[model samples]
Target: MVELSQTLLNLPVLICRLRGDVVQVETWISASGKHGHTGDWLVRDYITGETHLRATSSRYLMIDKKTRKLSFLKEAWADQIKPHVLDCHEYPIIMGDNRKLLQILDVDTADYVRTGLSPLWNDLDINQYVNYHIKYISWILEGAPRSFLESHKLSAMTVEYRKECGRESMLHNLSAVSRNGTSATNSTDHFTEDEGIEFDHSLYLQDGSEVLRARTMWMPKSI
Candidate 1:
């Protein structure tokens, strides 16, 4: 179980993989409590130590598999993991409450919509829920326009999970809208750009209930 799920946010620069390039990953617990703990990952070049990507995950233990209810960390387990907790210097590129951004994009008037079927495999985590990373990939494959994908590359993304689905075939109804910029929220400032485009995504089930909501930014392909 997790809150906010695992979100990957990219920096302004494009991340490229080169031959013979060695990379290093460092991860630590950024926050912990009775409910859950937040982990952060920093990926960088081994030679120059230049950061390539950053990700954060809010995870919790499941108390009941049937109900998918979360459990608080036990005293002994929390104590053992406390030694590994470390503060993070770098933060996600996309920050703050994204509820407003999700609200701003109307799925009914979405620029693109794609429908597909996704099945839950038995090999998934104990939670049996769809992985947030997979959901992002589905958004790209089903929601993004072909021309947009040809010219732009994903830069950053934020996903908020709503409901949990089990080992059944799910109707993936994904809608996407292109936006100029993000709206202002409590902690995030309003910003607009003339260049790069922002994409807001909403994924729904067959019953019209949302499975997850996400927002992503894409940069133009370099010549």
Candidate 2:
């Protein structure tokens, strides 16, 4: 029931891997594609490290609003002869877009994703579950500013940082899982008066070779 609309669907995506329920897309295509042929990777689904359904489109020239005709891919490159090669042997090439870089779902993460909560009771498709997660995560980290502040602020940073002290995990890392960026605290100074924040930060990776510490202090910048 939850279909990925335009904003999410058309936004440039990179190499995206769906492991169990964990989905991440990384896009490192040429930025110049925006003007001549903006390359995009639409990750519909993945299975066993293979792309299930994907769509890739190119931009040749601007399109006519009423006619929806292109004036670029042909106007400049003309035939150009695209190659017949797959970065990896995959399936489901449903458009004129390249089907490279699609990855399979990680079985470990897929289990979590497949069993995720569904807005519709009883059951929902994998896509639907992912949609719900996107909504839930977006709700938590609604504002990027708040996420940064709470996750990296001066006062609370030590609490998490200290927790990640030992255990041979990585090093001296703080793992304060939050939605937004800032912390839920009153202004240390006369700054914020409304709203509390959190962050989606990960634990640090330390090796004991160097002791790292940070804080929120006043520092006069040079002009």
Candidate 3:
């Protein structure tokens, strides 16, 4: 059942009905993986019953959170039968492991999260591209002001803004040592950018290289 269900996910289930934003998926449990378990699924577009997307191997799984186990149902799965979520989404949702793409490509990324704008990975100006990385950073750190960032860019920029923020997620893996000198951060964008946090970050390069640096300074008396 699980294997059969796995194939169903690979098949593009028809979006037969969409009300509000929910999408209905008409997936199937094929006849014992005849077509191709991770290979193919019989799907007809709901709008015209026209076959649009074909498939071979795909990624999908069902997990039972409470038990910390997975439920591989050979049927179907969709948060919204109507798939409405995609309609009003602010960020672009791509399938597959995007992390792998970033890793393989070795795209150089930097995060100068500060009161100043954080850099956008997509909008790498020649200077930023040339330098280890440079550009006013986009202010989309997880807790950074969301509405504030939204205000700068149109709603459409949310995805870009988020991608901009994610450009440096891998940096956390490095050690954040105690600050004894002036190589510490004090982001004007984040008034508390250095309020009391024990952190000094590194930059993630598009070339999959990291430029490590320290940020330190004497506590300023004036704002």
lDDT digits (tens) for residues 117-210 of candidate 2: 1133322344322223233223222222443434332211110111112222332222222222233334553333222332222222333231
For candidate 3, which ten residues in a row score worst on lDDT? 154-163
Q: Quote each prediction's TM-score.
A: 0.73, 0.18, 0.20
Clashes of each: 0, 31, 42
Q: For model 3, what is the C-alpha lDDT against the true structure?
A: 0.28
Model 3 residue runs over 4 Å out of place are 1-60, 74-99, 102-151, 154-223
lDDT by residue for model 3 over 5-24, one digit each (tens)? 12111212222233543322
Where does candidate 2 have its weakest 10-residue lDDT segment?
214-223
User: After superposing candidate 2, which stretches have Cα over 4 Å from the reference?
Assistant: 1-20, 28-35, 42-47, 60-223
> Root-mean-square deviation of each candidate, in angstroms?
5.3, 20.5, 19.6
What ranking of all candidate models by lDDT puts the best one first?
Answer: 1, 3, 2
Off by over 4 Å in 1: 1-14, 32-34, 59-63, 87-100, 104-107, 120-123, 181-194
By TM-score, the best candidate is: 1
| Residue pairs that clash (backbone atoms under 3 angstroms), model 1 | none
By summed lDDT, the worst window of 10 consecutive residues in model 1 runs over 1-10
